[model samples]
Target: MMLQFEGVVATGSAALDSGIGHTALKTLNDVTYLYSVTGPGGGIAVWKLVEGALPQLQDTEYFSGTITFQVGGIGMPATLAGDDQLVLDVRTATGLIGYDLNPDGTVGPLQETGTLTGGGDISALVQFGDILTIAHESTGQIATYTVNGDGTLSLSASIAGQADSMQVLQAGADHFVIAADATTGTISTYNVDQNTGALTVVDNSDALATLGIASPTAVEVVQAYGQSWVVVAGAGSNSLSVMELAGDGRLIPTDHVLDSLHTRFETVQDLAVIESDGHVFVVAGGGDDGVSLFTLTPGGQLVHQDSFADTIHSGLQNVETLSVAHVGDELQILVGAQQDEGLTQLSVSIADLGIVRDGFGTVTGTAQNDMLSGSILETTLMGGAGDDILNAGIGATTMHGGAGADIFVMQYGSDPTTINGFQAGTDRLDLFDYPLLRTPGQLMFIATEQGAQIKFLDEVIVINSSTGGPLTSAEVFGAGFGGPDHIPVDFGDFGGLEPGSSDGVQGTVTVASEAANPGLSDAEIRFTPDGGGTISVRADDEGRFDLGLPSGTFEGELEIIKTYSTASYEITALDALQVLRMSVGLDPTWGPATPENLIAADITRDGMVNALDALAILQIAVGLPTAHEAEWVFLDDDTDLSGITENNVSYETGVDVTVVDNVISTDMTSILLGNLEPV
Candidate 1:
């Protein structure tokens, strides 16, 4: 299945005039409600979606009299207590407001359930089961409240702490909470009693102090690879940190930190995780970078994927919050930016979440000739007792051909699929979107470390087998042709010719210079064969040319001629360093100095000859200590008197002249002292 982008929907005047700060999702029966809180106007907005082929927006409600001060957080309980009656809780500056959301997308009058002591400001709230927790920034405390049967909250317990953001997650039957202290730049962990609604501090000392966490604004928990990981976003430090939940319910840093430069995680405000099938991704929104995507590894590590700034849509500066939900089969990402007035809706495939599952449960085929298709998610298809046709779209899949001979169709770009208990002699592999049989000499069956690779040009299908066994041509058919004419053929007969023809060498020719010279364009590249024949080509505007030559182990002379000067060189592995030196206007012999040759020393390619270019050439010539042994031999050329010279001077002056040979030679001192010791 594919996810196509739908247009963004405005949350009416309440959200546009006051700005949207937070959002939550609630699905009841056939309707899905998107609840959002306004920033300054202290209003609530609800958008309804009717589940259908594609979930469609049904209605919108804007209630400005929900709270007094700006709303900080909003959440719903894990489960509804009454019949289709949901309770939505909103956290205001000094108190918590509870609203009863009816099935028709309308809410009752707002009720002030509980208030924080000392006039503390509520920053965030999260609910697990019937227990709700609120982060009070001013009082530096985390207060717990019990959800009453009448949709009201009663204060149960309070844990002294300084936190601006908090998240509650459940692993198995155990519950845990992670809170972020923006003031002290640390994160605190707590274990929750599932029965009594109490929190116990796991670490008395600041646990995240060693990480140098600063101004952490958001925290999230994601389950991946059979493990639970907590990801924290630091707005002050402009970084993201990952931690794994230990068996004892404590948080352990993974030492994997993504800084601002690599992730563009600037002024990170909020983070959200979306799990589709078995793949999981973390999306963070902040600053001018917009929203950033990251994949969670099985080991609880975060890998940066992409940024939406330049790739998706621009002008999303100061993006504040992000929410992701699976509406119908597609996952929708809602982005709320501070400067941007409205929310931006983006739709992406569930497969894009990076989850690679076995499949979406088991799909059984009917009797007689039946056809079944799978999504781009991991799924299993069973051809139950019939000559059934199975089509597993792009995702990794496992197919079971039960009973009758089955025809499994494969598509290009599809993930590796396995057919268990294969009746190879009877079943057939139908190739779709790929014309492997029609394209002669394009398919290759070669042995790999994993097993064998069936290559169709640049694409490959891996077959897990230790021995390099050949696949029958009849087993695989080209697109659209599935008949007796498609007979079994040998995999060896289709081995294509080598690239650039079977008997030739191909290389690129580029102009070498100390500084970039636009005038070097259209230079003449002449190759004189050792057999007395010459081929010439003109360099493009970029001073590059593709050179192709007949297959032969012979030395050839190359000449590059421009308007200023001409350079004559040989095409040999030993001359590679000399060729590079010539390109930068440096004489390989260090015998003569010329103005035109010095022009080529702009190895930095900044369009000007400078000392930096000479230094670059010297470094390459004197090869590093870890260089290949053969490279050391090249530097041992003692007959070449072109020893280390000062400032491109060809004459040997009173300056100490050490004949540098190898890496350990005393002459190496001169090379290290900014003298040109030829390698």
Candidate 2:
């Protein structure tokens, strides 16, 4: 996603440092603090991170004295000694210095200090567990040291290189250090010894000139799609380069992005990576009087998202450094504005860069607003919640705005896409991409049986409206299309139900079955006329239905189409035993066996409730397939349904019914098959 302009904090007098700006953030007991070091002239400045309507950097403090001449700094919130105290580590031109951060938000006395023997200025500082690494910018020297429990430092190892900016990438148990040398114009990767904290040369890429990266000043690492990536900001060429960090410590340059006229990336100095939602965004600041944002794809591509260049309003005057922090659900970036001499606190908005996917399949979104673009062949986009934007590419596309206001975009060559759950006033059809189709008045809104059809040229977008009504001009956003010719709203054959039709008839059908008082839940009843066609309606849990019939006379037979719950308490082995007694001529007088009870006991539908039916009922109780033909039996209330014995039984699925004056009333008795004592 793109980075939107948020609030900015001025560094004030703290901006006088000559080197590139660097920032670090640490949270202690829910309170966040920002540590900033800008070049050679400044020491270390700390600000209390205040988050509210907008993030504010207030109550600035300084760890002054001999800690000046610093170029970069890092905050170790958890030290190697296992103490949960924050240690502020600053890299000076001469060496490295560490300070204890007091709980009162004050800088304590010097905890430890280390002197570098190599002839070079300290450029960057990064810590991995107990190992701390420092990069020498001028002489290209790298040093590794162990941070002692008592806040003392011991040299672990040293390597020769023009290290300008360094980043440590931890891949499981293996740790690798990447160094960017601005002077030598080279990027180096070194393997770190986990136990001894020593650096071993793996490989180096001296192809900055070949890759158009003149000066690789800043470097940052981010993990996406289970792979690690190193994003380098080249100040010499005003560009950002992405390289895949292979697991074996090899750097493979994949893709790079240069500053364009639309985005200001002039002389990019520092880079910081932060993940918003599930997207990985890289924020860069440089000589340009603005800040730019880019998304790093899993394939190591730098896709430019957005940029803001208003120095007066954004306070991003020659932004030198950036560091990201998560303030609750909000992602805030502390920008070190070198020219403004202040830090700008910017919050990350959920507005993502355009998400483009090719081919087909369904693309679903979350509760947050999302931008989805589908191209090539049939594709389906379903926006579950929030205000979403769905871009219809080519071929057939199905879009559903499950909730919230959504925009359905139609470009040239985009086949007609089906739009579901489209609220007329809330959701709009975006036809801005079409040169001929501009204004809403230019488009034709025709109401059909399938819903509303928004037509322009040969392209058509079908909207599945809840009310099945045509849309208005207010539901479209664009310029003038072929227009001026209005298509009248035609409800046509779907205007509504006609009189005397089954669907037009309003009546209630309640089923009384052998399931206590509120009989047979979730039963589907179908009314088939003697002529042709069928009308169906399902009863609710209370076994009642506001019958659905067509708008015409219905001379038909009503039958139970379907029933629920194959497994019921009535169908059990105990019921099977009762049926067994009746089959053997030993009538257990739970009640006088009626014709309905005898029909229900006929599990095999062979006109007899015998020992075979009892055996089937026992099988049903154990969840096994039974020889029962029907799960339920429904018969008409009035008929020769009496005196049906084991030798004589007859039944029909449907009962006779006729609609007079566009209304029909009928009732049926239901029985769960194989249930002998269903009371």
Candidate 3:
């Protein structure tokens, strides 16, 4: 699991008056709206999730001018309504204010639709279906209102209760409400009549006596491991309590209890559950500097996972509320701090929870022989120990097999899939959807440099081999077929081909530079196999070397390192020029040869060194015009002759007397430049 701090956004009045007290999230048509109450003159400020290089925020609206009162809580629809209307209901000091959310996630002007009498102090608000429930802390009453089509609310029913916080849950056709009282330290449960919208008291539990839930501040209902559990946070005791909800709306306390001694739950204020990939995570925020994380186990136990604290931005003050929203494949946690006057966003990855997100669903496997399938989104399937059968759908997939032999079933028209740790002669590939056996011409098994390519119509399935050997038709296509619609192919001894054999590729490499004619010797070369592993060899004294590699199509990089200089070359087995050779004189021999050995021997740089070099040397020796236009003219001066002279030199002097002597002479110019050859 990885945690990324995505900075913070300030939310308060221009006078630096108050802090952000509450937060809520609403996702509509792939767009998410984060609503926060910015203290005194800070009405409701809406932030929209904008997709960019990273998930960012755009302030859509701030309703402080329209509603000139303090807002305590805000609520939005969990799922989309049939009319496709985006509405937000906010709890204020006077009454409930309703606003319509525009397509861009911004809110319109506030409309005072519903008003509460007798010292209205709304502490919490939640919307379930078309019913908006408001918890009035000062009046000690729970009120339910009907949401009109025009984003207005009308009073429907009122029930007597003392609740500082509230949450709603629906089981089957029954609607239940759970409320927590900070004064009495009691948790009350009620069943709402679906027809009349009347609340019926079901049961109550003394949280202070059994679970030490003193001054319960917030309550949330989370579904985990095929059961519904109610989680509560207490401010006075600074603890968390987990209770199982029975069918009759009875709260049963679980053994798992999160206290301040174990977690940073000081003055716990709010609780939110993030459900993803078959895992349930509870996020709690309070006077503590950071947010605490806990995962619900299969046995209904709350296991503390980790905690995130931004002490610089959100100190150990009243870090009141938190909410989570899913944007695309990312899960973002939004924290609102009362003292910090800002909102902190955190990105979370649940891979450490052993849960892999695949498209719209999550698929997991066991250690024994198991069967796994794909989903609408990209999927990851892991075969643990025993032989398993894995099936891929239309989505892209990544499959890996552990110890035992495994089988993979690939569907037609599906996205390309990658197979890792596929053992040749053991595992098999099933082309069940394509029916390659019935119509053999529809599929072509083309041998590629990486391994083998199974071409089906417009799609290509690449089989990467570890030994860098090409897979033969006989080694891939099954010998005996059980049916025509499904072909079970086995890669028998596909990657088992030995080097230097008939199924092996042999190539020679040579290195050269302008400073050294023959080439740089003892240069180290490295070849990285496309499938896996690496092979290394060194150049000989003559800068020439030979290597034998597995015959399969190879696709990877070749690196050459000598002295202080280094170079790299991309090579593939499909190239016609398999003989890898390089020289400073030629453009580089990555293909078949044209001039062969003499191509790189052009030392005079005239494209070719022929009789022209000899003619230039003769002209220099006789003090005539020379065509040699290189750095130094040969045989022009005594120093040039002395520098060119390597093996033989002779000088004779006669003293003014004439004498007849027989002498044999050899021209030094012919010996020095006549033997020049092209590389």
Candidate 4:
């Protein structure tokens, strides 16, 4: 069972003396209240339980009048068949008392009392509907009572046995009460009739004594692994025993575990069983100022998981009483401590035994805050959603904190831990246990093509940025470190198309002609670095060029210059006439006028259009040599080409391109010399 120490609160009333031996929970209306019973010369105290923003017991002195009882009484809550109000049943050494409990968090008058004639001090009691069972410590008798409408108890049946603690267990249609007898060191099971409160002894044995179990103080029934099992707290021997309940109410001893310093099960006193998410967990509070948790496996074995000691501020000093309930969606255990004189609230969760059994493998957590760690083998830990803490064990481990602010912990002698999806400033790296690596400045950061790495004395952690960006010192966290620093490393020249290929071919530009136009052959591509130097290259006959621009920080536009080529002539007199007509207000014969037509008509390369530019285009069209500054004017595909008549045609020649993966591919529309056809 995964157990977490939530918090603790004191039972505020001074009337209740120390040694809180028993507690009972009563939920009325929508509020739950806790009643704590102290030892001899002590009184009962009630607190309003609030499970809101913080799980706590709100101090509300609902009752001031103290009822006297020998030693401390065991209390439980019951509701009348025809009434909505709750009733408090208390079994003391001498008799049983029933108090009227109002739904408004108030204690009413004492309704009824029943006297015990010939039994010893009542050790434990349990109520099922209107039937009540009490165990006598000295007389060795188990008595059954019928709670009448007026809260009076009528004796129905009695059995002879030494019983210390008792709990009700229902299997199918038969009801049974399992009891632990410390005086005889025996665990007994008795069958009960539903209609009339009567007990019939089914099986009783001193089998626990053979297993070194002495003075069993508490017994609890849990239904797990598709069967009923009884858990007994061996107080004298400082151990716990588990027995399998057969169909006929026979208690067959199955497993038993002794207390150790790690488990802290000294002086085991009480056991509370909880079933959640298809798992059964047993919570034990011991007199050794400790609390231990266990889970039953499908194979009927008990697995001890976590333990908490009072030395850890757990508030479990002389813990005598424990009660569990579902507070909101969380299973909360209320612990009553005698020596500490307070109540500690603990949270319980089912342990992922599958992961534990695997020894080393991929482990995934739930959306709630998880405390997950790895084993001493190659393991992978993934904290799915909540803010989690992941401990890297002694193996090459990979950790991914899926979505929340998480902490990755590293200890000595573990293999290097690689962290993926590590959010800088959100997630943290804990290297406190790493020898001599105390500050961030002491570590060295190396930049690579993949990501960055932090190394310190044979330890290396690879931080893989999910965004595929550069990793910096801002992602490193440790003690004695100031705010995040932008650690700049020389991220060597980004490679070319192939991996590790130099950025020698800095850029590439391809020019393609219009649908029915001539292929752009032997085009000129020019690249100007940001600082004001130009490098020009000639494309092949196919109009494709691998720009060998120098490798550096070049982040601006580059100019492309291609003068008119007299060798290629697709334009004729008809195209020149079309451009001349477009120079005037008339529409060109080849197509409707557009901005590209006006740009093609500007043969002199000036921003304006007139008849002289058309004359130069006509001479070039007929294969007669002519002087022209620019033969082909390139425009970006997304540039606005509308609303442009002659003089307003401001040609946009620069194609913006940037190197990403060592290569840049740019495509531009080619406007050949005086090809007035629509481009």
Q: Which residue pairs overlap in candidate 4's backbone?
A: 140-161
lDDT of 2 by residue, 1-679 (tens): 3466666555456443333256777676677777665544455566776554454444344545665544344443435464443434344434444566666454556544545554225556677888878765555568887878775567889888767578899764588998887877888888999789888997544323335677888888977655678888889877777776766676656555667565777898878887655567788878887777665544344445557675466667777778877666566777776666566666765543233333346777766666565544467887777666676755578887767767676654456778887786667665544433335666677766646777766678888875666654444332222211111111111212111101110112344322222443455556665534344444445555434332455577777644325443556778788888889886655766777778777878888778898888888877787556336656776766776897666777667987654355666666667766534
lDDT of 1 by residue, 1-679 (tens): 2224354566456444246777667776666677665654455556665322323444444445534444444434333245232233334434554566666666555545545452325666677778777776666778777777875566778888776677887665688888886767768888888677788888724336545667888888877656678888888866677777754575656533544443545778888886666656677777855666655544344544455552344325577777778676566767666666556665665422221322244666655444554444456777766655665544566677666666666544455666554454555555423533543235675644434456664444554321234444333332323321111111111233211101111111122322222333544444443433333444445444433232233244445443311121111223344435554656667545332233233334344445555445454445532111111000111223343232342321111111112001111101111122233
lDDT of 4: 0.62
Query: Is 1 or 2 the stronger prediction by lDDT?
Result: 2
Q: lDDT at 94 for candidate 3?
A: 61
Candidate 3 lDDT over 398-469, as tens digits, reads: 676566656666655466766555566766666645523343345687876656777765445667654556
Model 4, poorest ten-residue lDDT window?
486-495
Considering summed lDDT, which 10 consecutive residues are worst modelled in model 1? Answer: 662-671
lDDT value, residue 414 of candidate 2: 58
In candidate 4, stretches whose alpha carbon ends up further than 4 angstroms from where it belongs are: 52-71, 79-95, 114-121, 137-139, 149-151, 204-210, 349-679
2 versus 3: better lDDT goes to: 2
Query: What C-alpha root-mean-square deviation, in Å, does candidate 1 show against the real structure?
Result: 20.5
Model 1 / residue 538 / CA error / Å? 62
* Higher-scoring candidate on lDDT, 1 or 4: 4
Q: How much does candidate 2 score in TM-score?
A: 0.53
Q: Write the per-residue lDDT of candidate 4 for residues 537-624, one digit (tens) a residue.
A: 4443444444433234344454544545444445668877886776786788756777777777777777777787888877776666
